[model samples]
Target: MANKNVIWCDEKTLQKDISGKIYVVTGANSGVGLETSKQLIKQGGHVIMACRRVDAGEEEAKAFGDLKGSYEVMKVDFADLQSVRNFAAKFKAKYDRLDGLMCNAGALFSGDQAQYTKDGIEMSIGVSYFGHFLLTELLLEQLKKSAPARVGILSSVGHAGNAKNRYKVHFEDINWKNRKYNGVDAYCEAKVAVNLYAMELGERLKGTGVSTASVHPGWARSNFGGSGVMMKVLRVFLYPFRNSITNSNEESAQTSLHVLLSEDAPQHSGAYFSQHSVLYRDKECRKGGWPMTSPNPHAKDMEAAHQLVKLSRQMVAL
Candidate 1:
């Protein structure tokens, strides 16, 4: 069981000088992804900001003028499978090694409308899980060549079934084609898939010197989940409690930084982490208080993770 009193270390305390390492951070235009890129640059690492909007990414990269390392903005629209392939091809063409890959881009639609990507897959699953699955698969060789590399998948606590509407990956109806659609459920299911992908990938890359981990960044003050009118109204009502309930983007990004660059990450490959600590089962957590660091049973089910990997490969036509 993880200690309830565990405190996350400040990002500034990281002293690992990653001077020549190269990293890729998706959705680096804003929020946690942007902050993560900044921290990596501060530690003397080159970063590729994989974004959907090249113009926005270029503008955002300018803010890092004083940073020690270099940065490049690459276009990658996760909603389109072709765009993902293009990004990977371009990256492989330019870079010889990839020290780290952060699957940080994600979205949540509030309304009941069903949205599909250019690939004709559910928008949430397509972008949050399938797109990342394809991207990581394409980059596996580079990561292995780099050796001792890391992949961090940004998941969410909602995957733990703690939300008002619980969710689990419906293998038979992954895209919600057969059943009624709920955007929140679809988002949670996609996150579950992301975590499972990390688990299965970690196992497959056991001896390749490349490691993977899934992380819950906690509720952060970001533009995520604000796409719908309902979400906007809720945000307005919850504005007063935002400071108390949500973490700053920088703070939310620490777990990802720890998993990607910390010396301790290798030993915990395939693990799920929150607040810079390994998550345990809910029953193993402290009795009285809510176990923020504990992962739900679904996240730890190896059987389900394996199944998800097989299904994902087929879905992406890999």
Candidate 2:
């Protein structure tokens, strides 16, 4: 069944009538986020680059001049709960409405060392799940104001079954005090949780026209794999495979734009998609192991999502 109705976005086609629309892009200083912002501005949308380093964001925003989509550099560090809070507060005060929020920031580590966030959760969970959780909730009212607002999460296919990520969330032991930390696998868990949260959020925002969709940008030759002596060896030795299998930043950014702007996206809220089309995962995803909206073979844990919200509130003291 070759479907021909799919509309894939091309970065070069920088001509969308998004003028005056407010768009918030997390981690907009580099990689796909930067690329995505460039195209957005070129097309006439107002872009607010939410970044950890305000200076870097300013420099990048300036590079695209008389930006069809006037932009400003806003500070937001996903690792720090306080920072996420500050960003949301400032954003709410500044923007009357939000047209789109692109949760395009994520990272990967190679070691099994357990890292904790300022909020006391595993480092991966904090930035990828809890932090975004708080940010989205804070700006939810703003999204409502924008009605027809969209949320795009940059997810990865790696969330699929892997020996490292099979840990059934021991809700009682989310801190990993009982299980040894596998950084890579822990990352997968957080991303899976993001998709699940999207499901719950979809139900909440249904009539408001606030849509949420997750995206897998293939692979990109980016700062995804942190640099270190060990990673150096892996990057050099595996350079051939990584380069060949991964996508360039240019091609990868379009998927996010497609989701944020395409007509098909809003109607398909709560589902994951890539390369501009809906993605259907195995039936296992419906079983109760992972959270809802995750393609993983797990049941949608509505309770867990609620619990996660409670935990985040306590950790950030929000």
Q: List residue ranges in candidate 2 displaced over 4 A.
A: 1-7, 10-14, 163-168, 238-243, 275-295, 299-307, 310-318
Candidate 1: tens digits of C-alpha lDDT, residues 205-257: 99999999887776666778765777689788878866555667877787788
Which pairs clash (backbone N, Cα, C closer than 3 Å) in model 2? Answer: 219-247, 284-297, 287-298, 287-299, 288-299, 289-298, 289-299, 290-298, 292-300
Q: Which regions in candidate 1 have their CA more than 4 angstroms from the true location? A: 1-7, 10-13, 163-166, 276-295
In order, what is each prediction's RMSD in angstroms?
Answer: 4.2, 5.1
Please give, for residues 184-222, the per-residue lDDT of candidate 2 as tens digits.
Answer: 778777776776676677777888989987776655556
Provide backbone clash counts, one per model.
Answer: 0, 9
Tell me the whole-model lDDT of each prediction, alpha carbons only.
0.81, 0.72
Among the numbered candidates, top lDDT falls to 1
